[model samples]
Target chain A: MTTMVLSGNEACVEGALRSGVRFFAGYPITPSSEIAEEMARRLPALGGKFIQMEDELASMAAVVGASLAGLKAMTATSGPGFSLMQENIGMAVMLEAPCVVVNVQRAGPSTGWATWPAQGDVMAARWGTHGDHPAIVLTPWSVKESFELTVRAVNLAERLRTPVILLSDAIIGRLREKVDLPPSVPVVDRPRPAMAPDHYRPYAGGPDGVPPMADFGTGYRWYATTTTHNERGYPVGVDAAAAEGLLKRLHSKIHDHQDEVVLTEGRWLEDSEVVVVAYGSVARSALAAVKQARSRGLKAGLLRLVTLWPFPSQLISQVAQRIRGLLVAEMNMGQMVEKVREASCGASEVWSVARFNGQYLMPEQILDKLEEVRRAWR
Target chain B: MALMRNRDMVERYFRRGALPTTWCPGCGLGTATGAMVRAIDQLGLDADKVVIVTGIGCSGQVYTLLNFDGFHGTHGRALAAATGIKFANPELTVIAPMGDGDCAAIGGNHFIQAARRNMDITAIIMANQAYGMTGGQYSPLTPMGSFTSTSPYGHIEPPFDMCALAIAAGATYVARGTVYHTQELVRLIARGIAHRGFSVIEVLAPCPVQFGRRNAMATPVDMFRQLQRATVSVREAELHPEAIGGRAVRGVLREVEGPEFTAEYEALIRRAKGDTHG
Candidate 1:
């Protein structure tokens, strides 16, 4: 392993290159600009293409187009840009175009803070696009994990034939850390059609529920549309059964393969009374607080979620049933906390230690909340 | 013999069982699309080497009717998607078919930027004056004082001069042809596709049911007659400016050589790889 000091955004770019991403179309947005800048410098050297698109929507559309044309592609943005990206991202979902979208989240309902950290886009990552679609969202807490999860994000996108979100915050995006990078990592390319172009159906999946994708100009002459489409990739207007089947398959393809898609890190969960569930940068502080609490004999544990969407429900339910209280810590105003509560099913007392003041939820704030919850439990 | 040859061309270029399109009776989109197909056939480009990227509009359905790889994407983003396709695989010919609203309103930024970049893509803006799919809403291409669904009072804003916009935005090739002039439209589209840089072929198609009904020209023939009477060849317009009056000039308005984006990017890649010759 080679040791290098890099920011989270730079690490993400490195990871994308390592994952065989050859095309990057992005607009410069705060906290995410470093990713685009690094890509612009690095891609051409590797014979890859990098384009600075006009806006987030165009960036996303370009990524989808590149993906369809047989190149692994990516784009990065912040909150306001992320909002602009939703429509095309929905098109990506409908078309099942495999690409990675990295939102280095900043504070915003709309352009709130360009340079500060906030995990306010958790829900947006899942349902920002207007549809009942499946989403794969990965949250990275550290610079090293940013690299690791970006690789995972691209791999999952290709494997599932879906767009994946690498949700990093401004703090994690800009945080510099010394990381020991591996020489090579496992890479997964999208499944290619085994059937001849004459008989190939674009949306007809094998057992995996992900159809083999054919690149444009590959003699498949396939059709892809943003409308609800049949297995042949043609729009099935007013065919309720076909639409339902398509929607279900789009969803079940991710949910059925949950074990492969979801990743988490747990610390001191055995014999713990209170568990702090957190993700992204807040998870770093939560881990530290859990360790500090353990040192003080407080029986605090941590569940650091690496996969946020398809929301690790079974695991959360199991943990909730075993724990006395669950404290959800995040840099947003009680977004994932609601998901936690829903997943817990009232099996444990759920409390939220939330903040959205363009600041990180500190270790002390989480520990204090843990203590308060523990006091109430006693 | 001509009918048999046309049938063969249609069979080779269009998808079987996809016809009887959802277009209104006498809609000029079909004629424009037919001209485009004829242009492609005349160029003798391989079907596998072409991809049609369509935006959300009636014109966007052109790709579905043709037997080629297609990307039917969201509203106003066809050019953006085509840009990506061309960058990813420069071997493929990218064509985008968009409506007036799709090209000038929501997708206006992408259109200008693509042209400015001199990307190798053919953009066919089917200017039907209003949004036909959504029941004739006023669009940026709707003429000033034209009646539309939203313009119960006459539309107050002047329509965009799209050919001028394309030229100013650095399009290497720009042309205008109406559906009434099918042969000229085919020639313009063919030439636009042959151009190596960004090309814009704005086909003035008529939405007889929506746009034409609101105006005096209610029938398809009426609209076609109006188009034929109201447009003149660019050469004719230049020679007899007084006789041309307010008629739209129909021909290649601008064609110039410029550096194509994908080739430039390839050279950039070579330079980045330390190739001195690049």
Candidate 2:
């Protein structure tokens, strides 16, 4: 173990290496470029490989390809690059390849503020790729959390046989912090098929929905495609029943395990009238506002979402039943707030505090929203 | 023909169940695939050690038909995928089988860069000069004044000379063969697979259903004979460059060893780790 000061992007690369990532294919994008640059510098020392792909599309395609070849692979990007990755991300979803994609988010619909922070990709990270497939997105509130979540993202991707998105922002990505990073963390490599090579069903798993994967050149000759396919991994073409079964399994594999996938942290929730829901760097501001409200003798609490996808809806719903009002604060105009409102199910009054002018939400702004909600109740 | 079908190479390499491929009858994809199989057989390469990557198109179906570790990726990204597969495990012989449009049009940048890196991967490009799977759309490889569905008034764009493009991009091995010359194609593909750096073998195969029916060459034999007549030897092409239009120069255009990307990457890792002996 060693203590060192590191930025979120640097921690991400270190955590990827500790998670046994041996292959990285990515295009350089601002705020996220540090992840690629660090990977290029450090991966070689560990005998891992780094490649600067031509674009995000190829970077994602290459990551999927490397994962299928039995390597833990990753790619980092932001904004426009993330948009370019949607098609191949769908491919990774359909093929059930275990890989991580890091989006060090910057402001934009199209290259908006390159060096600034934005939480605009919260919803986009889940539904960015066009399909009904499940997405796993993790938000790191601090630099240390960035390292932990990077490792968690890789493990979850390997365990579930799917792509995991480490949804970060420019603030956390560039923020430097001192913390203890272990020399090595526990790595969860995808299990290889133990079945006979000739008779193996590539998409058939054990009790879990994830199937054991075989690397290329491992004597397990099989096929993989992005099309809806059966257990055999060949294209199912127009087999409606097969497609239905495949899609159902893919969804259930994640949804059925939501207890394990969804992560959240609650502060002052035991007894509170108003609760603020926040994620990413905005969570820091949210905690401060909750403390300020408490100092002013107002019963306020905070609910921080560490995992953005699979929604952690059950926890939100449960908390909604206890609290009187909820305020959602984020860097975007309103993305995850809609999810917060839907999950609350009218049990509590839900409102959003948004900031999209290329700035993060401040604690004072969140405190103002909390005060407004309190006044409305009077 | 019966004896050849009974040979161990065919029985061992082809997955009989996956046979009767998705390709139409008289489609040159079948011949192109056969040549690739023959090439692997000639090299005595282990099937388990071969990873075939293909993109969306009629040519992309080759990976599915072969009994090897295969990846049928998204449209036009086969080479990009192959680059990762090769770099991840240099022990495996990575092969990307792509269509004219798959490699030259949508994936053009990846194609040029992959060659530029001199990565150790074999790329077999089936240059049918048109998008065969999508009802004969004109592609970047579609020759000037060629009529197709998208170019009903004849194409205005000039086609890419694939071998020349690869050669200029620093491919260590560059060659061209027509589907009509299956034996020669087999030899060229074998050489490509054996090359230590990036190798591209462009097979001028025919897309009878999409391309032939649109042009005057309606029959499979017409397309085959056209290839036979238009192909000139590399020596003949150099001696009489003027007569090379509307034709392909066959045989190995370039074969030279250089710093292969994966090997260089390994050496870099050794140096970074202070493994001076490596």
Model 2 misplaced stretches (Cα beyond 4 Å): B1-7, B238-246
lDDT of candidate 1 over B1-278, digit per residue (tens)? 01225677679988888888899998999888888888888888999989999999898889889999999999999999999999999999999999999999999999999999999999999999999999999999998888999998999999899999999999999999999988888999999999999999999998999999999889999999989998899999889989988778999999999999999999999999999998
Candidate 2 fnat reads 0.86
Model 2, B1-278: lDDT tens per residue?
11124256557887767777888777898888888888887788988999999998888888777789989989989988898888899999998999989999999999999999999999999989888888899988888898999999989999899999999999999999989987788889999999999999999988878888888889999989888998998888999999998677899999998999999998999999999999
Instruction: List the candidates' TM-scores in order.
Output: 0.99, 0.98
On TM-score, the leading prediction is 1
Q: Which tens-of-lDDT digit does each residue in A1-378 have in candidate 1?
A: 999999999999999999999999999999899899999999999999999999999999999999999999999999999999999999989999999999999998897989989999999999999979899999999999999999999999999999999999999999999999999988999999998998998998779899999999999999989978899887897889988989999999999899989999888887788999999999989998888888887899999899999899999999999988889999988999999999999999899999989877899998888778777877
TM-score quality measure for candidate 2 = 0.98
* Top DockQ prediction, candidate number: 1
For model 2, the DockQ equals 0.84
Model 1 whole-model lDDT (C-alpha atoms):
0.93
The lDDT per prediction is 0.93, 0.90
